[model samples]
Target: MAKGAHGSRQAAWEFFGAELKRRREEAAFTQVELGARVFVSGGYIGQFEQAIRKPQLDVAQRIDETLRTDGFFERMWRKLIKDLPFEAYFAHVAELERLATKICQFEPMLVPGLLQTPEYTRALYEVSHPFATPEYVEEQIQARMDRARILKDATRPEYWVILHEAALRVPVGDPITMAAQLDRLREMVGEHKVLIQVIPFVAGAHTRMGKMMKLMEFEDAPPAVYTEGVHWGNLLDEPGVVKQVQGSYDLLRAAALPPEASLILIKTAAEDHRRCAKST
Candidate 1:
């Protein structure tokens, strides 16, 4: 599969789903029955079969075992999603995010992908990938926008974010783009789509500086933590590590301004950007 090709990604996922349905039938098991063995709901299995959702690696492994396919599902999953726009280390996290019931994120610098606007994302890519083709940057922006869609689903996770003041102060894209981006956050907050808190510069140094971490909780599986740097990402499911990360996240949350106050600050920041743009 070619990298960052949306059509190819969808087609490969469809093929994976078709094979899953065929094998389940060959094994004389209904979707509900298969889902039971894999520890997901019957509706979830149907979604997978219809390519409406992608199963995570562990679930794929369970499907392989349940259908006596040795490693077919697992292997296919790895091969099919490897070409996604995300880095190799982050592909798994992307899949898992779909299944999460809650997501708590801390971003010390730029806005998190799930909350970033298209213009904001494009600006980041332009500066970061200065020599890349426009197509590559657009593909990445599309992927980010796709990732953000989970927030709009009726079954959307309970999303919460803690942003350092720096994220709001940093000028990403043009002033107009920054204004729109911050305005989007304010809108999401007002619509009750997400809960947000911002750590002000006065808070001084605190936990989780110079790092970004996301804690995800699932209904059917243990929680996971994802951390990312410039070129790499890590996913941790180990209970101890997850616990520690959770504690640190709690600390960060405590240091942040209350949601109402944060909303006011965001509004102010958006106005600042808008005024700056107008003055220029």
Candidate 2:
């Protein structure tokens, strides 16, 4: 039977635990026997089967070897890992991206951060990682591009993004690439699932926080807010606190143009970039 969304997440936990239990039982091994093979206590084996403890790589390998299932744990690891090159920082973002029913993003940097073009993102990363080799930059760009692909899937989440005017004025790459990136932004506005807003520099200082923020609403879970900088992100899910952050977002939206006007502003900026590219 097809499971509902909430059921599916819960089912993943159960399914993973049950798989461990089934493998042990199928091998004619009791909890104590399996623990002996894997160099763990019987209580740890029981906990593994009960979804109370996640397996480390070494333990996972030991468990797989004792069960004689070649690469079972490795296969599961691939499934558990998201397409993230940034590791710990991206983990929370990955979960939110997967579960978000609606996402409201406010980006102070160029474009909505998630919708950033490879050329633009590379330039930004390059500034931050000036010491990074070419290969490292490519890795980051590929990771970001892969992250963006989630929105292309049939189950794409609803996305509404607000971009500060400063984001529009900043040229991340060379003029040509900048213009192409702007054009891409313009084209993306046509996507029915995305709402893009450009808050002009002329809007002046309102809720002038220097970083970006995302408000994610979920199906069965309470909404959360995310803020990221450099190497870390904080996810706020506390009840009353999330409400206040959302209220702040509401006021921030008021400081920016409505959807229609925001579109016009974005298109005009794209056209200006195109003109600049041609002149240069």
Candidate 3:
């Protein structure tokens, strides 16, 4: 039987969960029996089957081995691992992003992760996780970098990003790192990999300030709106809510500078950062 056919249509993770359940049953293993082989509780297996939880990489691998599925679960786990480094609440959003046909995002404070350079990503992680071990920090940086691969995929999504002027101005690291970050944005804009609009400081406050919002449109699923805070995030999929948020994002995009002008502003900011680094 096809995955997810046993239940209402849902996200890819849910489909994966359904497939896991089907395979377990075909192998004549009860949830408890499977959990014993995977070293997790029967309840955890139930959560996986119901798509209420995601399996860790190790757990997925163990399940694959126990079920003799020839690495089927492990292969699916690799695609899902792109969600790593994100909070658990937002993992599904990451998966959605990977599968999206188009993505639009607004960032008020920092550069979007998809556009961040490795150096820039590292600096952000170091500051945010002040007490994290070097290994952990490196692991997170790698995961962030890995997420960028979606932008380079054969079927890359059409990306449109609206960045607040404050995000460009605030120095995440030293002048050099900031300059490189800005240059990176300029380079991507030049390459036409993404469409960028800058909400200039002169434009003043507008709709959807003080929070980061991303709207993702998928080819096979309904659109989603994601909003995030420092330690938490919400993925909104209700049709009414998604429509409202999409309208707000459209307004914000209209209020921002045009792409040509935004590119200039970004390049100018990069030059200014370079000059500041030279003077200091």
- Predictions ranked by TM-score, top down? 1, 3, 2
Highest-scoring model, TM-score: 1
Task: Give the alpha-carbon lDDT of every model.
Answer: 0.88, 0.74, 0.84
Instruction: Name the lDDT value of residue 88 in candidate 1.
Output: 75
Best-performing candidate as measured by lDDT: 1
lDDT of 2 by residue, 58-172 (tens): 6778888888889887567455544235565556465567667789988887676568888888888888889999998998887677667668878788998888877777788
What TM-score would you give candidate 1 relative to the actual structure? 0.77
Error of 2 at 112 (Å): 3.0
Candidate 3: what lDDT?
A: 0.84
lDDT for 17 (candidate 1):
91
TM-score of 2: 0.70
* Candidate 1 lDDT, 1-280, residue by residue in tens: 2345656777888999999999999999999999999988787788788776778788999999999998999999888767666887788788778889999999998888988999999999999999999999998988888888888889999999999989998999999999899999998888777899999999999987888999999876678899998798878876899999999999999999999999889889889999999999
Please report the TM-score between candidate 3 and the true structure: 0.74
Error of 1 at 138 (Å): 1.5
Model 3 misplacement above 4 A: 1-16, 19-85
Q: What is the C-alpha RMSD of each candidate to the true structure, in Å?
A: 5.7, 8.6, 9.3
